[model samples]
Target: MSSFKPSMSEPKSPGSYCGVPAQRSSQWGPEMVLVKLEDCSHPLELNVIVKEEEEERGIKEEEEEERAFTEEQRAVTEEAEQRAFTEEQRAVTEEAKERAFTEEQRTFKEEAEERAFTEEQRAFTEEQRAFTEEQRAVTEEQRAFKEEAEERAFTAEQRAFTEEQRAFTEEAEERAFTEEQRAFTEEQRAFTEEAEERAFTEEAEERAFTEEQRAVTEEAEERAFTAEQRAFTEEQRAVTEEAEERAFTAEQRAFTEEQRAFTEEAEERAFSEEQRAFTEEQIAFTEEQRAFTEEAEERAFTAEQRAFIEEAEERAFTEEQRAFTEEQRAVTEEAEERAFTEEQRAFTEEAEERAFTEEQRAFTEEQRAFTEEAEERAFTEEQRAFTEEQRAFTEEQRAFTEEAEERAFTEEQRAVTEEAEERAFTAEQRAFTEEQRAFTEEAEERAFTEEQRAFTEEQRAFTEEAEERAFTAEQRAFTEEQRAFTAEL
Candidate 1:
């Protein structure tokens, strides 16, 4: 064996096959070789030689042609695969968008449902408020009726006095009574105007509340519209509009019911009909909302999308909640105002009643005082008239007695005159009994009318003043006449 020669190292070109050099097997023909250089004794490793280059050039030309065909096939395959992958990714993205949109719609529907529920609760509360207002009106009416009854009873007691006194003071107090009537009318007018003002103010407040509700609704609608625009779907917008219409109708019904509560007359049929309609409509809306929610769950989405949508939904819910809270606050304030108004009205009415009572008491006192003074003056005049009448009657009786003694100087004539006197005395006694009955019927003998008392005094001065005064005066006149006659004899 030749002296051991050092084996040449393998090529270090960049091309490799299972860690083998590209310059491997240069002596072999243009074909793959299974040779291990380390197994060869004195392995001869060579660079790409001339024969190998020429053969390699020829083989490279063929490989280039084959490579071009293979490259064309592979490019076609890669393009097909890329197209398939792109289609699948696009399908996934569209599915994700659909899922996200469905989830957002579901969330929106849930929020809408919550708002509707809240609105329903508010409507119920408003209905209760209306009922309470109706109760308050009824209570007020009852109170007014009670007050009127009491006032009438008081008036009846005032009228229970003697008719004689009324006549005495009728003309004197007529203007005052008329003034009181006018004052009462004015008071009633003031009450009516106050009630009207309260109604007007309530209407204005309701209008303001309606405006606030409309503004809130408009804002909510704007948000919904914006959300619809974001969704870019016509179906969603229609549904949202339908929901808004339902909510708006419900609100309108609530307002109508509230106004209906103020009606003095109760119409139960119409109210029940409206309530039934509202209930049916609400049921339908709930069914529709539920259907919509069920339909929304048929898709899928990403966590980030869900998070964003949840945030938006939370914000909307927060806005609704805030509006509800504000509405509650407004309602509470209105209730307080109404309560205060009622209390003030009661106080005003009580004060007016007390003032009226005071005025009436003063009027009655003045009337009594004036009547007493008139009676005193009339009594004085009656005494003077009686004194003058008695003197004239005494002179006439003296002349009559002289004529009677001259004309009736016969026994038969005296007997006829005595019979006539007896009949006249009986008639006078009957007349006295009649007067006594009349006096008893009047039930106020001492407080008889001025005309009756004066007539009685004048008649008694001519005949008998309540019988007792005439009897005593006649007895004294007889005694004086007897004394005079006896002195003359």
Candidate 2:
């Protein structure tokens, strides 16, 4: 018998023939045979042989068995080779399908990346165009504003110049009028002062005259009172001397009456003495006759002669006293008559002086009243003259004030007219400024609308271009995939 050996061309998988095992044949001696593995794509064959001593006695039987085994082995080798060839063809077809799918995926990714880069470029160009347009519009607006400001400044300068000229002329006119009014007021004040001075001087002179007249009247009154007092003293002196003379005359008359009574008594007594003497003689004669008869009557005749002598002497003395008393009474009566006449004269003079004094006092009172009336009339005349002067001054002042007011009214009217003209100019300038502002706003609105319309048109065109590019890329990818699929088939 021979041991089994195997030959390999290349390395193979470990479990390629997992289900097949080795077996021995009973009819044949112990020998190795060449056998092919079945599950592998390539045929694997091995050869072996066996030798024996009793083989001549059964030679025919062994020769027949060998021929049958050779035929069976050849059939198995052919079947294994056919199955390996089918498996090789299926593996080559699958490799070609995988390479086609990988090429399609790479092309689609490259197309998508190119589309995104183009979109970014388009957006950048649009942003740059919008910025340039905005800068141009800003420059144009600045130029327009500069021109409008220059025009407004020119108008303002002209208005200021005209206003300054008007103000200068008005100031000059006002200064001239003020000077003229001042001079007129000064003259009026001086005239009023002179009139007041004259009135004051006249009043002073009248007052002095009134005072002098009053002094003269008072002096006259004093002199009249003095004369009346002196007359009264003289009357009183005459009355006293008359009263003294009357008292002395009455005393002398009383003594003379006593003397006259004595004289009458003496004459009567002498006659009585003579009668007695006669009676006594008769008696003596009778008695003597009687005595002579007796003694011769010698003694009786002597006694009768002595008695008659004594009686005659007493009678003569009484007659002288009566004649002296009669003379004294006559003188006394004449003195009493003279004293009564003197007293009457003194009373008459006092009465006359009192009447004269009363008359003088009445005259003085009348003169004083006349002087006061004259003074009052003079004062009234002075007051009337002063009132007339004051009225004239007031009239002149009123006329001057009216003239000044008229001039002021004329100046005020002129100023009001100038102010009205200035207001009109200001209103016109304000209206012009409003018109310019409205025009500027209208222009800005029109420019903004135009810019919006242009931007909308550009965006629409960009969108259409992007859509066309995407459609073309999709068509090219489809054609490439179809061509690769056909080649694989």
Candidate 3:
């Protein structure tokens, strides 16, 4: 033998070296070959020979493997480049799909954003249109309210002014009526005065005529009484003279009888018996004559006493007539004095009535003056009130117009808030109108109540006065009746 040559060491494949050794290893490929080793633990390494067939086979197999790997890689480059090349392929494909999905998501998000933006724009436009419509409606309502208020104010002012004018005219007419009443009363007073004066004059004339007639009758009675006294005195004087003449004749007859008796006695002796008897008869005749003379003287003295007593009675009667005449004169004078006194009393009463009338007239004049002044003041006050009311009405109208203009301006300036502003204005106007209406009603009620109270008081006073007048008239009638009955008694 050839000298023992050293064998070339072969690669060993890994096996269980302690238990058993590997016999052989199958050929895997050029990348991995199977081999068994003698002292190697098992098959530690795989060895391959580079023969044509084997190489061809290996190459083919390698090519086939490569081809398969390339296909897998394509399915995974399509799948992952078959693992490495397949893994590279798979990574590339996954990256491309991710990029495509991201692009789709981005496109979808953009479309959605566009749709939302369009919807928001439409809603905003609708809200703006609604706000504009509400503002217009409020403005129209405010305008209508202001116009109606102005019309109401105009009507109230017109009515109040007409009432004031009518009241003023009525007061003026009342003043004229009072003046006419005063004139009529004055005329009545003058007529009464004239009638009283005429009555007084007639009474005075009648008294004067009665006095003249009484004086004439008194003179006649006085003359008759004087005539009766004179006649009685004359009759007494005639009886005295006749008795003196008869006494003188009786004295002469006695003297003649004495002389005849003395002559018979001296011549009677130696004459004769027949002569003696004749002398004695003559003596008896003388004695008888003496007795007759005594009787005649006694009768004449009794006649004188009777005639004196008769004359005295006639004088006493004349004195009584004189006293009667004096008493009559006194009564007539007393009656004249009483009549004069009555006239004076009547004149005094008339004066008092005149004074009362004058005082009443003065009071009436003063009242009239005061009433006139009050009326003038009232007229002035009413005029002022009317003017003030007119001015107020004008001011109210102007304010209303201004308010209308302001509302228009506000509507234009704040068209968006016009509805709210108009509501506030309307509420304020309603409150003011209610207050004014209440005030007017209160004033009317107060005025009517005052007028009613005054009318009631006047009626009461008139009734009282009428009752007093009736009572006084009844008393006067009773007194007059009593006086007439007494006079008759």
Q: Each candidate: RMSD to true structure?
A: 69.1, 77.5, 79.9
Best candidate according to TM-score: 1
Higher-lDDT candidate of 1 and 2: 1
Clashes of each: 3, 3, 26
Candidates in order, TM-scores: namely 0.23, 0.19, 0.19
- Of 2 and 3, the candidate ahead on lDDT is 3
Please provide, for model 1 over 1-489, each residue's C-alpha lDDT reduced to its tens digit, 9 standing for 90 to 100. 011123355634333334343344534544423222443333434322123335545765785587568657756865785576568557756865785586678568756865775576467547645754664475356446534653553354335332323542356455654665577568657756864675466456545644654574465446434533533443343345435534656468456435534531243354357447645754564465345433322221232255346446644654564455446445644764566577866677655665575477558757755764564466446535544654454355345433432332232234334434533543454455345445445535433554475566457545633464555466557666654753452
Tens digits of per-residue lDDT for model 2 on 299-336? 21232233234324422432342233234333533553
lDDT of 3 at 348: 74
Model 2, position 159, has a per-residue lDDT of 42
Model 3's alpha-carbon lDDT is: 0.47
Residue-level lDDT tens digits of model 3 in 292-405: 434534543454455346435633553563455446445644765576577867677755665575476458546645754565466457545644654564455345534533
